[model samples]
Target: MSRRRRLRSRMLALVLVGSLAGLTAVGGPAIADTLSDKRAAAKKQEQENAAKREQLAASLEGLSAELGQALLDLQAMEQRMPQAQAELAEAQESLDRSQREATLVAARLQDALDQEVSIGSTIEQDTARATRIRESIGQMAREAYKGGGTATSMDIVLGAKSTEEFIEQYGLVSTALRTQTNTLDELRELQAQNANSQARLEAVRGRVQELKAEADEKVVEADAARAQAQERKDEIQQLISQQAAKKAQIEDQKAAAEAEAAAADAEAAKIAAELAAIAAQQRAAEAAAAAAAGKPQAPAGPVGGSLFANPTSINPMYVTSNYGMRLHPTLGYVRLHAGIDLRTYCGTPIYAGRAGSVQWAQYRNGFGNQVMVDHGLVNGSSLMSSYNHMTSFSVRSGQRVEQGTLLGYSGNTGTSAACHLHFEVYVNGGTQDPGPLLGR
Candidate 1:
């Protein structure tokens, strides 16, 4: 009997020990819960850091593109400037050529006028001499005709003492009369020819004057054309100046944008460093906690929930899509998926993820009932987030909301296959991947 009691006591001790082990197994997870929580918080911070980094990168790229375009504009303006200068030079050359031709033509016209004046003087002198000679010949003819016809007949009928005397007297009378008539005729003809020559010379002089006037007019026209061309060049130069000023202004804007982007990049880096440090600290804490409890560290931080500070269930949960490339439900082909989709029962409550002011609330083509919130300006610019596809809204367009405040309800109001939330973050006006910021 004594031996049986000892064996029973030993069996009872074994049973007690087995029961204690079972209770410990059941309570082990609860004991290590704090470690899990710490790890999850760390991971959430890291995810936010990554999202910020992406935003910074996108801003940098856009700034770079703007700067490049500005440079091209400035270069085009520079090119136009040279062309305008060349055109101006050409216009000046044309003006100079016209002026020189006008000077030469004026000199030639003066010479022609001088020659015509000398020729006119000579013609006037010749005309006066011819008139005097004709008047003398007319007087001699009148005197000869004054002798009666009977006296001229008797002198011719009476023979001279000798034939020689008669012949000489007759020859003398005839020669004198013929010479006077011929002299008068030659003077008249010379007078007529001199008048004609003077007329022709005057006509030539008039033509020279006309040529001078025409050349002067042409010079004036060329000068006007040159002036017009110069004016055009000036206008082009003015345009180039304005364009250059505009380019400078745009360059200033680009510089400002680049500075802003750089600042954003720096801030993102700082945030990432803080997140990494926090994660390391949490990991250290978790390691200590696990050692103390003598169990494996719980898999902290849910797969998609490691990126936000306060992740909570404000609305009923459903996952419609996940990250990475997937065949688009509506686009009908493979496309890069930037974020995950959270579906819910139609009209279910949707809540704010953080404290912020409502920036905009409206309907969009694909997003339907969209709501954008401006948390605040970061690195010299606004940091905004948007939520889309809602059946109804709870908040006004510019209402402020704290974390977990009701924002709207889920719906298929947009280009959606079903009722779901389409969320996005923006550094400026561009879209960014929302997966990191949506972590829980």
Candidate 2:
């Protein structure tokens, strides 16, 4: 390699050594635990279905016929904007962390490769040194054989002219023997070191392969995180845009909604009110019956369980919203949905719930084209049923009708938005939950 390239390689190899050493010193499990915790937390947030539902339901439930509904729309929008903004912030943070992880993984992969290259170089040097040692040792042995091995101590002493000459010959032989011994020892040490480095190089290469895979996964995770963040950002922006338009819409509908509510309020109260028209009709009917008999009246029949047939045009009736006190999520005010709202199309047939007298079949103030049917005495009280929000009526007041008598056509009239049948069951005068009565 060129000088510059070699220098760069060395630098990278040094980085690899330091990084790997740190990892080894800390231990793999401890290092993995930190990243594992973060990843687990991010994965946990993947189940955001409930949050999505809350957002969707809140947005949809706010638009209805009541004036409170328009006001509800505003409140729901207020709640959603802030919630979306907060989620967006979290998503952005997660994206940032994932990107950092990707970058770290890329660096580690490169370092592992550098460590493998550097270790391979060390192994080569060791092999070269061992070869040189072997050649040198071979030459020394051949020279020794040519000279007939070594002079004995007795031979040295006898051949010597003086004590100094004997000492000098002994010293020369000792130095030659020591040189061969040192060379052989060094060759053995180099061979052992080279084997160790070869193993280490293989391990480094394996680690490089592992790091490459981890790097790819990190890249994918970072991209997904970025997409999530972007999606949240776009959603928040859309909500912001809708916020202004919704507020303007509420202002436009405010007067009409208010008028509708005002008209419906008194009639709505009468459904559950003690001083209701149904109560008066009940009292009058009982008096007329007693006078006809000229004796005490018979005990009323028992009323429990499913007391009425399906009153909707649907083959099998389906209730859209149940009868209960529904509190607006944002407004925190409870409103009574006094009856069950059934899924009915515009101009669909509306049935009498049971055999009864058709008392009123005209447009009541809030009920639009309303039809009230008196089911007569039941369980010592008068039972009545009302089918409201119809386009037109077929029956009139004082008409005797059998069960399933077609009274009107369903519509989106009065304080209603969509086309449906609002069915109410009143015992004596007060309206109650119609679930039990409606179920067949």
lDDT of 2: 0.69
RMSD of each: 36.3, 10.0
Q: In candidate 1, which residue pairs clash?
A: 44-306, 305-440
Each model's lDDT: 0.56, 0.69
Position 314, candidate 2: lDDT: 92
Question: TM-score of the candidate numbered 1?
Answer: 0.40
TM-score versus the correct structure, for each prediction: 0.40, 0.56
What is the clash count for each candidate, in the order shown? Answer: 2, 0
Runs off by more than 4 Å, candidate 1: 1-77, 100-104, 107-115, 142-159, 225-261, 264-440
Instruction: Please give, for residues 261-358, the per-residue lDDT of candidate 1 as tens digits.
Output: 45534533443344345445555666688889997765433222223322124343444455456552111345444444665557777777667888
List candidate 2 segments past 4 Å from native.
Answer: 1-118, 138-162, 256-351, 358-370, 374-384, 390-400, 403-414, 418-421, 424-440
